[model samples]
Target: MMQENMAGAHLIWMLILALVVVIPFWRICQKAGYPGILGLLSIVPIANIALIYFLAFARWPAHKSVQQDPSS
Candidate 1:
């Protein structure tokens, strides 16, 4: 049926959109020294917001220029 074909097309477009959005986030997480899989957390409502806060506050391992004092 034409409706079924349209539904399939819509689903495919949505999946493509999700991939387009998620891939960059995944790469950003990886660059930030967090697991790329964490980007998938964006699919969750509350957790995604939490993830943003976590990434904002957490120390990134990739940024080696900022050395920490061990004596503290």
Candidate 2:
């Protein structure tokens, strides 16, 4: 009984942690002009590393548009 409770708590903690990571990523992806769904990658083990690298180095569509503006 105690083990089951502990396992359930662990699962809830994991879910909470995933949400903590995902929500900010979702907002960031939207602000970057990328699909918000890309934030789901944050919950994946290997993909999270790839996501960070991509976000760090890849050109953001929003930035591109802003840079292309003649008014800027």
Candidate 3:
């Protein structure tokens, strides 16, 4: 029926939207030096939700530069 088709279409669209939103955040988490596995954490219960919020806002530590200061 037309209603069934429309529901299927809506489901697909929602899935696409979810991927669009999650992929970039995954990339961002990696860019911020978090483990790639963190992306999979998204499937977990409440923890996953919390992790995403943490990743989106937390300022992770930067990679330390190796060059030594001559003055020290």
Candidate 4:
């Protein structure tokens, strides 16, 4: 029983560790123009696993059209 509890605790810690590394990096990706929820897709199987890799290393969209200032 004690060993099982320890194993559960270790699993939780590993998940927390992954989230700690992913969340802020995800936010940065969002600010750089990717959708923020793209991080959540990282949890999906197969295709999403690839998506995560792509998002992690992919170039964020930096040149999308933006509204111009009327004062310009």
Using all chains and alpha carbons, the TM-scores for the candidates as numbered come to 0.76, 0.90, 0.58, 0.54
* Model 3 Cα shift for residue 48 (angstroms): 7.8
Q: Cα RMSDs of all predictions?
A: 4.0, 1.0, 4.5, 4.2
Q: 71 in model 4: Cα distance from truth in Å?
A: 6.8
**Looking at candidate 4, what is the lDDT of residue 60?**
59
lDDT of 3 by residue, 1-72 (tens): 999999999999978876776677677677777876676556557877898788768766433222333554
Identify the superior model by lDDT, candidate 1 or candidate 2: 2
User: Tens digits of per-residue lDDT for model 2 on 1-72?
Assistant: 999999999999999999999999999999999999999999999999999999999999999999999996
The predicted structure with the larger TM-score, 2 or 3, is: 2
Q: Native-vs-model 2 lDDT?
A: 0.96
The candidate scoring highest on TM-score is 2
Pairs that clash in candidate 4: none
Q: Which has the higher lDDT value, candidate number 2 or candidate number 3?
A: 2
Task: Give the runs in model 3 whose Cα sits over 4 Å from its true position.
Answer: 37-53, 56-72
TM-score of candidate 3 against the unseen true structure: 0.58
Best model per lDDT: 2
Clashing pairs in 1: none
For candidate 1, lDDT tens digit of each residue in 1-72? 999999999999988987887788798899988799998877678987998898888888776434554544
